[model samples]
Target chain A: MLNKVEAYFTKELKEKAGILVVLTLLLLVPQYSWRLFFLLLLIASLLPRDVHRGKIKLMVSLPFSKGDVFWISYAFLITIIVITQIIGGAFFNISLSGIGWDILGTLIFSSAYFGIAMISVSLGFGNFGIPFLVLIADSFFGAIGNNWEFTYNLFRSPSGLNPYRMISPIYQGNRFAAFVFAAALLITAYILFERKGTSK
Target chain B: MIVKVENLQKSFSGKFVLNGVSFDVKEGEMFALIGPNGAGKTTTLRCLYGDLTPNGGKIELFGKAFSSKSKERIAVMNEERETFRRLTGGDYVKMWSLLYPKWNDKIFSNFALHYKFDLEQRVETYSIGMKTVFYVALTVASNADVLILDEPTQHLDPLIRNEILKVISNYTLEEKKTIIISSHEIYELEEISTSFAIIKEGKVLYSDTVDDAKASHRLISRDEKASQGEVIGLVGDDTLVKTDKDVGRFPKFEEIVLGYLGGRREFIPF
Candidate 1:
């Protein structure tokens, strides 16, 4: 069990660590911050595909249980989330000041997204899930990109967009959204990780 | 029994890659899966090692029902370069060894020594054959009764190929371990395989013991006048059907078959 877990981290997270750092640096560079969320989704989905690919042929031939799938996914997601948090905050300057609510949101987003990426890339045949994920994510990203200043007003940013809209005035709209992003990811990850695949 | 697959079936796009495939691997038996490209051989091997989930199959390993998640009894030598390029061969083995409950560094190092694999060098600098040797050592080090190998000989030199096969064959004989190997080299399989299965076009065309496969079919050839026996085999650039049999020395039969296979074909002249 420990070996599987370790392999999951090393293969899915550590193996991709360099890329993750490079990507985080890319996201932090002022103007390119717009690409951060979408890139995050893409990177998360890409990590485990190779390991899963190698295993897909064997898993289909052998006997696998849902619990095994869930654990594998969970293990992978945690590593990704931890890496994302470390890189995002330490280097990219993605803050986590007040908004205690943000942590819950981050955890959720991390879990959901980690799971989503796990299931999406783990598909046996085509890239059906990727397009589906991109369709929804791209549109949302587009909305945010075009109206970065506008969304600042809606979800009640900590303070940047609106002087008195939210209690934690120090929190920027992007910060709150990151937490929400984390929440969204968590919900999705758990669902995908738990969902029964067509195979069995 | 080391492993048992019951009523296994895997489908993609409504087509079954492995359909109702079932079998028992006796302890210490070296089994081979021989089939054409796109055959269920790789798929079947994947299912055995927890790399895939069968649409409908139950696997019992070491007297326990193995669900998709229950993988405490098997080891797999997967295809996509399991070793991290930056890590030394020894470190890679040790890293994985820590995770496996059944890992035995002694056995792994012994296999590495036998194979002449350099343990101190970074894995990425080595060739594919070297990586395979490292993977085999790590997997064997796990000491899992069941070892699932997919295309272990792909891209391997003849000498290395024989060496790996020798290790697997010898291990199964000396220890009561079970190995499932998928390969295109039917003749090499003939030498060491106790059981065999053939997959073609995403299905199990036939699966049985080596003796049964040999007994069930005959490889007869003709110069120009072919017999009426149905074609039941693949010969060079043609198919051998008994009913439409025009068996000539398939252009370059000996050279083509042996060359492509790395000299692993056993022909029965008829």
Candidate 2:
């Protein structure tokens, strides 16, 4: 497992370095929304492009299993997300005590987007096409829900209160639903990835 | 058997690419899957190495069902020679050394010396022949029990191509390893391959050991009528017939392959 991780790191060192540079530059932006959008774009572009470009063939041809490949990529993406969150918090002068919840919210939000992107890619949607469309739809719905009372009420917490509203405004409804949705998409993507031919 | 593929089926976008392909390789044999382009040779190799999951059928490696653990015993050189393009040859060696438990640095070094490969240069800069050689060298040094190489001799100068074929043949003999190679280079493959399966249009046309196939089949002249043998295919004006009695001249390995693959085409005379 460690060997596989090391192999991936060495193989993708250049791409990873480029990602880090772009991520750091994004963090420098004052707008949190813009930074988050670019971060999601980066995450969405990660695994799908590898599959599309037939890089997965090289990885599977080695001792690594398909599951190993998927989990390693996911782990690497999560690690990047965590590191960038920490860096973003520090850059924004957010106190360490106040950063944990924000980091957790970012993880949840990013995971949901990652799941969407993964399933889209697995279904033969190009890396950027469907995921970008979903992002646009999400923004459109969120904006509409903010203005319309009925739509806003549907997405609002049952208790009429959201403690993490500032962190995760997307999941304004039951957090359980958010978790389930993310889990379902991720599970579907995993199944599709495992069953689908890597020749694509 | 070192490797077994039974009734393997695969399709791309509803079109059957591998329509029930099957073959087996014994231990220490250089088995060749010979076919023209788009004949499902690469697809079969991909399925054998777990690069592509077959839509239906079974693939067994080393007497058991193929799985992730099975991959540990196999090394593959894909048709595309896919690699991390930005990485140098040295980087690949380093990465593979860590990944393959049995990787032999000495073997890789020897290949580098012989090929005069610059370890510092990225893989993308290498010519197609160099890249093919590089991948072949990597697979050989992996020290796996089985090697699945798709189009190993494609896009190479004749001298290097022969050298590569000799290296492949020697590796199987000296290391007692099983190799499943898919290629359209019938003449070269016939020289090295012990067993062969001729595939056409996603189906196996003929499969047997090189010696047995040659012994059982004969190339008869077009004018001669063979009443004692089953007609396999045509080679120019001559007919390739499977026979028990010595009727016509025994077919060369490539003649047999060509007869099987080209036999179906209607000979048009102007």
TM-score of chain A of each: 0.46, 0.81
In model 2, what are the clashing residue pairs, if there are any? none
Task: Note the DockQ of each predicted structure.
Answer: 0.20, 0.68
User: How high is each candidate's TM-score?
Assistant: 0.65, 0.92
lDDT of 2 by residue, B94-185 (tens): 88888789999999999999999999998878999999999999999999899888889989998999899999999999999989999888
Native contacts recovered, each model: 0.28, 0.81
For model 1 chain B, the run of ten residues with the poorest summed lDDT? B251-260
Per-model CA lDDT versus the true structure: 0.57, 0.81
How far residue A187's Cα lies from its native spot in candidate 2, in Å, is 1.3
Docking class of 2: medium
Query: Once model 2 is optimally superposed onto the true structure by TM-score, how far is the C-alpha of residue B197 displaced, in angstroms?
Result: 0.3
Tens-digit lDDT track of model 1 for B1-270 = 677777788887688778777777777888776766676777777666555556787988777776544455577777555455456776676566655677897887677767788878888788887788777777677777778887777778899888878888876888768888888776677778888665555555555666544444434443433455544545543434323233443322222223323222446698
Best by TM-score: 2
